[model samples]
Target: MVHSNRCGYTYIGESGRESCCYRETWDDRERCIWHEEIAADETKPVEQLERARAPPEVRDLNGETGPREILDGTDVRGTVFPDGMDLAGVSLRDTDMAEVGLRNATLTGASLADATLVDADLRGADLRGANCWEAELNDIHLGEATLEGADLRAADCSDAILRAANLEGANLEGAFFDRADLFDATLSRTRSYGAVFSEARANEGTELDERCVYDHNSDADATRQRRESGAVRSDGGQASDTTVAGSDIDPLTKAEATYQELESLCSENALLSRQSQYFVRRQDIHTEEHWREGNWSRWLRARLSRAVVLYGESPFRVLSVTVAIIVGSALLYPLGLLRVSATGQPLMYPSPTEPIALVSTLIDSLYFSVLTFTTMTFGLYSPVGAGKLLTMLETSAGIVLMALLVFVFGRRATR
Candidate 1:
């Protein structure tokens, strides 16, 4: 006797507790629609004149037939919402909602802790601030859903399809996301300490905050300390986005760890192109961190890497910078930087020794500048007094640029 026809749903309120007595029967079962044992009962669609009718309370909330308040606190656990449902702020912890069709449902602030939501269809659902701790969410289709600030800590989300979902500031600590698809998902500010992302699928569009290192040490406990902090989230609820942070570990260390972890994931999934993207970002954070700590050598190397080849990500930039150097050096050469090797005559714009054509002087200076930059000067021209120093600088810069270009080209070819 799993159920009776008295609609015996219990509801506890601030005043007292009460049991429902709605006279209805879901098919041949001895219960109302709200009290139906949907998980246990097997059925086939058929015309039955005595079938149960939907109560006036939960009448078409998503379609705006009724307000969202009527269905709150109702015991609709183990019930399937095939079309769509609006149960915002509903207390439905520990429900057997596995394999249900909840497409486009509004469950904001609902308590779904320990619920079995395996293979459920929650695409485009709004679960903001909903407590879903330790829920079984494997293989659920939550594409384009809004789960911002939701508490999904320790939840089993393995094999879940979360494409384009907004999980910003959500508590994802210790959650298992193995083999989950997170393509184009926004996980910025998510507390993902001890969270397993093994084999999880992501791309360049997947947003992750390198500086979000909210580990267990930084956050005292999941529930109690967070509630005490009273920090409101971006979605108008309490989330893991509080400004309180601990300095026990360097932020760059955690940021590098995150990048390395993701980079390895990309490499294993044959997404090698995304690996360089992560590498450049990792170096950026490393450079910024070292600059603040006064590490001149590390900062200088990182800065040079960016200026030369964009940390070896952009091969085009290498060629562009080289061209810029050559053109700039050519313009600087006309200011008495070159001389004739045969006559030892200085090459200047006005030419105090003789009236030189400005156009011809510029052409000659450009030719000399190109030869000096390539470090292959002929006997027809020579560097004058100050030109010797300028030539040395230009030659050094050219050598470094050429070497970096080769390295960048080789790296890009492998990718």
Candidate 2:
């Protein structure tokens, strides 16, 4: 049996702490909207009712018989616009145009608060100064659209295609852009507080401000591309306006300056990925000799470390080197270059007499090579003659390898 509140909703689950009272707050005798007492006199706001009513047949903005409408300030709430419909400056507050075709629509300054535009085809639309608060724009295609100064608070734009879109000075607080295509889009000064951009592809020209906090698991490659390409300037403005006095700067020179600036900024901030990308770009653009002139030792060491340890990111490379060293030592041992001996006794040289003897000697040599390479001693075998020198070399290599492994693992842990 279920315990029912005055709203007729059930209180299910455990009786005490783990129960759910599916009803409105009980403070001040409040009841759910569906409760009979509340439903009797419930009435929607007049503005909402007016918005719920459908608009007249679409027409041109000039009051002509054309399909497009320049009905600026005209309320077209709840209207289903046809494909290629132009409703520039029209008010569409609380409209229910779900699955409507609005491709190439001119909805500039349109009010779309609490509207349902699910699956709307708004590609190439001009939505400058538009209001889309709490609107349902899921799967909307807004590629190449202009949304400058648009307000999109709490809007759900999941899977929206916004490639090359302009969202300058837009307020996008609490909006969702999951899997959205924002490649080359300009989001300068766009408020993105609590916004979700997981899996969104933004490249160079995708400007950002300090307020933006994306999902940590978002596409790192896209972020790096934006940073390296100078698409992600700190200020929410056009890249041309970044340097006040460089208005006449040539494109190549400006690009180079931006790269250097970003490189310096990223290095200071300890943004290693962006810094590495800039370093690589500098290497590619400059002459080989010129690029390698200054800090030659530092550059050489950095490159060598990356190759040997994969920038301290790969354990497989470490393992491969270890295996190669062991194999090389094993092969040398079997060539009669590593006879075993005791500290004060004669050396135990290999005798390739019978097939069994040769096989046993080879196996023993391989085992001894492995033990020496690992710097481990069982006291049962010791190196003689040239083997002593090899043992010392192998021990030193093993120590270095072990130290590198430790450093790599520690760096990875902190990262």
Candidate 3:
């Protein structure tokens, strides 16, 4: 058990255990025999873990202020209280109170700008309007705390627990939140430009401020869309409530909502194409039973979706595929698989009347390939008897490629 000399409270538990309500560590040698059993109880609730919680205490400079009098106090700007102290409403500007254990305290309007609060246990504390600018708050626990209107600009909150904290109207520009657990924290109207939220967990009711972009591969973009759309939450915990009753919701209403959801997902199809495809396929199947019947057709469609338009997300892939087909077909002509004619007469690779170079023959073949691929009747070149079969196949492929290219371009241009 650990005893506080300042507050007269006894904290009985093992050190560093989250289940212990006490912020300070327990010393076994100082513990009584009866308190040993309480220390071993791991199943104790975190809020109820403390057997005795001392009343709020203050350690003033003169040591004369009473607990009630400290509530209305303010001038403790730089006093060092090197212990577990709860000094609410105290103005501690430019204070160097590093590694302090002020858990669950209410420090509303306290000015702690330029303070050294590294590794502080500020869990469930209220620091409304606090000036913690440029403070080193690394690994601090502000979980479920309220820091509304706090000046946290340039503060390093790396690996901090800010889950469920209310930080409305806070100025957090250039603050670092790398790997911080901001799950369910509300940060509405907060200026967070250049703030690092790398690997930070934000969820429902977590309103991110402007210019707060995350990694390309992270769920931050999706979470932003969901939160801004008011459709989904970042936590993936629950869905938003609708005004209409479930029983009374018509199929048309459900369909419209689903369409909006699919549209939103499709808009971000570069990262959400699979999810968008699922919804699109479901909707397509419901409208036409034929879409659900053919396995080969669906398989072909899935492949086409990936290869042609890349699920309506990439135009580059479509262009690359089209170029490959045209070039591949053109190369086959130079290999003597198909014969070409320039004037409706049979033409060999080595010209009899004029000696054509290998490069010239290849260029003519490419020209013919482009015409054949586009199905254009320029009549500059014609395929010989057996070559007609290859020409017909090329023509069919050209038509399909043209249609797919148009579709891809349309999606790209609209997007």
Candidate 4:
């Protein structure tokens, strides 16, 4: 039997135990907004569970706007005397939660992945361990929210106000932080690889790792690796991972464009080395896309450029490639036509007819190769037959390599 004066919200556990916690009641009704029973004598929260489990359209049709339909002038959600509106542990995944007033709501352990929470007021909510991966958190007011261990990977949190939010150990990989206000946010040990913090306002109290970088790996694989290593959070909870199903819309192209804007952000911050690293990563992804499209010519070009100079990030590779070219050209010159400038007497490596030393002919070929590579013809040696064409090719290669070397050096020296 339940008391008629108090709120009668009954929570039935998986073990089938019906427990009714004491809550304040309305003066005219038997229950408060959170604990309001649809039926006069229904003790179990059967209708509440059914409403939560309903489909998206079904919930909309049944008015998923929450109990704000009833006026509580004395109190508002999120600012209650002791406890707030209890929506805790609700599975709101893939629901249209946009512009909803969940302020001060208790959403702990809620499955909100892929939910559109744009402009929702969730200020001061307890959202620990919530699966919000890939959720649209744009412009959401989560000020003072407790988000420890929350899965926010790939979530679009652009322009979201998360001031003073405790996001310790949250998985924020690939999450967009563009213009997001994270002032005084406690983000200790957060996995923020691939998260773009472009133009995000933060003070000294905001614990952000300056060394955070994008390593181009999936969030699930990273989480699984951490779990396999038996890692635990600061709150004495074991690290857990959740696999998100595909979203309704694939934003891969938008993500690529967003990274381009992030690249500019790095340049604005004078992080040239980081910018170069990001450029290489973007090119690698594009090259992979080309490979998937079966564009063999583009793939070959990308591979050759990467091998030659590592996309201009490695200058030593460029020098080594030039050295190899010089050596190969020198060895090939002896096999072609080589003649003295004063006389048309051809010099061959074997010297079958004349009895000239092999070493002398080889040295001459090496000298000519160096001169030909630099495009510096001293008129001491001449080339006929195939040697003329080989010298032309080597000269062109020298010109291209010298320009590339200059560009690489300038790019590295600036920042």
Which consecutive 10 residues in model 2 have the weakest lDDT in total?
66-75
Error of 1 at 137 (Å): 1.2
> Could you give me the TM-score of model 4 versus the true structure?
0.52
TM-score of 3: 0.37
Summarize candidate 1's per-residue lDDT along 98-200 as a digit string, tens digits.
6677788988877676677888889999999887877789999999999998988668999999999999878776578999999999887676644778999
Better of 1 and 3 by lDDT: 1
The TM-scores of all predictions, comma-separated, are 0.68, 0.40, 0.37, 0.52
Q: Could you tell me which residue pairs clash in candidate 2? A: 61-70, 189-236, 205-231
Write one digit per residue (lDDT tens) for candidate 4, span 34-140.
44433423233324423323354543443443311111111121222223655555545545556656667777766676667888788999899776767889999
* Candidate 1 accuracy as TM-score: 0.68
lDDT of 4 at 404: 86
Can you write out model 3's per-residue Cα lDDT over 1-415, one digit (the tens) per residue? 5345222223211121222223332343232211222321222222322223334342343234321211111112222333334444453433444455566776775656556676677777888867676677888888888898786766889988888888876766557887788777887656454456666665534554322222222234454333222222211212224311322443333333433433433344232443344345444433333344566676676666766666665667777877887787777765554443444444446654555566677687787888888888577666665567777888898898778778867865654
Candidate with best TM-score: 1
Which regions of candidate 4 deviate over 4 angstroms?
A: 1-4, 8-22, 25-128, 132-149, 153-176, 179-196, 201-265, 312-314, 343-364, 409-415
Worst 10 residues of 1 by lDDT: 65-74
Candidate 3 lDDT (Cα, 0 to 1)? 0.54
Q: Which stretches of candidate 1 lie over 4 Å from their true place?
A: 1-79, 164-174, 183-197, 202-254, 258-275, 351-356
